[model samples]
Target: MTALPQERRVVTAIPGPKSQELQARRTAAVASGVGSVLPVFTTRAGGGIIEDVDGNRLIDFGSGIAVTSVGSSAEAVVRRASAQLQDFTHTCFMVTPYEGYVEVCELLAELTPGDHAKKSALFNSGAEAVENAVKIARAYTKRQAVVVFDHGYHGRTNLTMGMTAKNMPYKNGFGPFAPEIYRVPVAYGYRWPTGPDNAGAEASAQAIDMINKQVGAENVAAIIIEPVLGEGGFIEPAKGFLPAIAQFAKDNGIVFVADEIQSGFCRTGQWFASEDEGIVPDLITTAKGIAGGLPLAAVTGRAEIMDAPHSGGLGGTYGGNPVACAAALGAIETMKELDLNAKAKRIEEVMKARLSSMQEKFDIIGDIRGRGAMIAIELVQSGTKDPNPAATAALAKACHAEGVLVLTCGTYGNVLRFLPPLVIGEDLLTEGLDILEQAFAGV
Candidate 1:
């Protein structure tokens, strides 16, 4: 794969003159609702750096919100996608069946958590996959209610907005969400009422009790969760938590859906985070890293559950676009060839060590958690557990100013998440962490 310079070179102020000029035009043309973290327009990006309009090369830690796990311009992804584009960009899979779509489904069936008879349907985005998973679950179970967890983030769609727990940016002023959705407590070990050791059992018991007393499991179609919560902070649910919930879903006939959008591909050490707890979900929603940079998502699950929907029940106009599917195949190939799973694990080892040391010095860092490359630090008050969103914001701003891309997310916005590309070299990773350390020091 062709590589970008594995260096952090800031030739100008963060949003340099050229970027500032573009920003002014963007301000007038783009809708106010659309938000951007770093406003400098990216002219080229690959490996671990993104070169902006003004030639500033920034270290990439966000990986385009975990969409570039195989790297932004993976050779396989680019080659296959480009070849497909040359042949035919879009015939619309719905209109004309394509080998690429079928091939991607075959791969997903083999890759997702379960070994049982499986099937898949592709979509344009993670939100679309999630929505379809819900639809399939309800259809299969002949039930209406869907259950999610606190500190969960599904999507911006009306249905997923109701599934998402946060309110401000995602759900503010946008109401009348889909009904029959219930929220339960997640096993957030760091913030759990009980101690971390007891968090799994406590949270599972509470969620089961709530489902029975309030939502009635018999009436529920699915229980969706992120194995390692994303955007809601990279909160890896306590060890036994996921298995307990999966068993509960099995016993109650609730379609257990793992929303692996942010945690899937090789972003986590495992191909799918659900595998970490050995909890084979009945349905798994995936996207982000699935197709390199191209938009693609899938709902892979038990064949019986997937076939529950009518023939015309699931599909989108542009679902599994040929080029995107080709990109997905190539990305998967690249992942296997390069063993990105091991790469993610190594990243975790490197980051955990560095971040743990940082945590020792910075008491504001309340917790460090996550698996593989999808790691994060929860910022809090110096001596208290109270979230310090201000500190988090300042730290991220500092990173941006110094030519590094870091993302902040959480219900309280007190999280700084690091999702570097799995292909990022150790040197770049170390450099980015150095920039993070400097940002923390300044903040």
Candidate 2:
């Protein structure tokens, strides 16, 4: 295996000749719907660096949107997946189940935040896992209505589209979406109508009231939420909000599903972000970092609730492909051996400290929120909470030009999110932040 130099190096233009040609080819061959944050094309990536075809080694602050928390090509992940590939590729778990799939399920049951008898069903993406969680909840509760939050992002599937709050890119023209999905206000502290202090109590109370009066708690099958909301900005619900919602769901017999796809797998210092609030969800959807970049997702929850569906109800052919399972096992091993949870906490400390300092200098940085390595800076008009999407776009472009891979998100399209690999060196991280400060100044 070739070890890529972790240091960032820009030998040519950001999208040099080689990447430019590839981008042209991609435009012709690939669909326009598949959006990319950066125009440069990577030939190799490892240890916090994405080596593009132009020989530009860019610092990876994105980590493929938190899919490669152990770095793009971790040793254990590569070794196990390679061994599994040589042994066998696909033997659909349904037709001929394998030990790797079962092992992953066992790990999920053990690692996810729960002390109950847990069970898991694998899938190929976060969206699919979420879809299946809804199925399980509906089957178990015998209800049709599902409650979601205002700024929560579930997935891109038909059902998830209906659950998602944003309409521009995710839901627009993709409708009409699946019925029986309801969206309610989230305890978004920064823009909370009353104030951050009251956000938790007021928002959760209002959300519960909506579920009771409008959807009717008895009619609700599930109340799914990202413990820390992704896509709709990395908005962590106000403190006390999660417990309140979880309690409300429990009081009403509604299956509480924690969509921890992005915030799970040590990205947020804990095994799952739900643990932060000591909230034990009835069902948790996981993906992204689960397989160290391989496409794998799962719905892990109470065994009784999970078994609600029939034998033939919840699985896909590629749900637990043996190779992907091997990768997952390796990824989990890496997380344990390296103590990535602690590393994630260290990252939170370092990043939040640096970003908090930056917020002092840049008024556009309206809010610096998020936990652990999964952090974000909400950009806004100077001295006001008004979103500054134009400034966000320009700043991202600036970072791109300087060979730093940063990403942007938010309902108003004005958040710069950071999800660097947990294994990244402090040197690279500090350098990336330096570039960020420079980019902000230029903006």
Each candidate's clash count: 0, 0
Angstrom error of the Cα, residue 68, model 2: value is 0.2
Q: How high is the lDDT of residue 236 in model 1?
A: 94
Work out candidate 2's RMSD over C-alphas.
0.9
**TM-score for predicted model 2 compared with the true structure:** 0.99
Q: Encode model 2's per-residue lDDT on 1-443: one tens digit a residue.
A: 12998899999998899999999999999999999988898889988899999899999999999999999999999999999999999989999999999999999999998799999999999999999999999999999999999988999999998999999899888789899998888999999999999999999999988888898899999999999999999999999999999999998899999999999999999999999989999999999999999999999999999999988998898998899999999999999999999999999999999998999998899999998899999999997989999999999999999999999989999999999999999999999999999999999
Estimate, for each residue in 124-218, the C-alpha lDDT of model 1 and write its tens digit: 99999999999999999999999999999999999999999999899999999999999999989998876899999999999999999998889
Cα TM-score per model: 0.99, 0.99
Taking all chains together, the TM-score of candidate 1 against the true structure is 0.99
Off by over 4 Å in 1: none
Residue 293 of model 1, lDDT score:
92
- Which pairs clash in the backbone of model 1? none
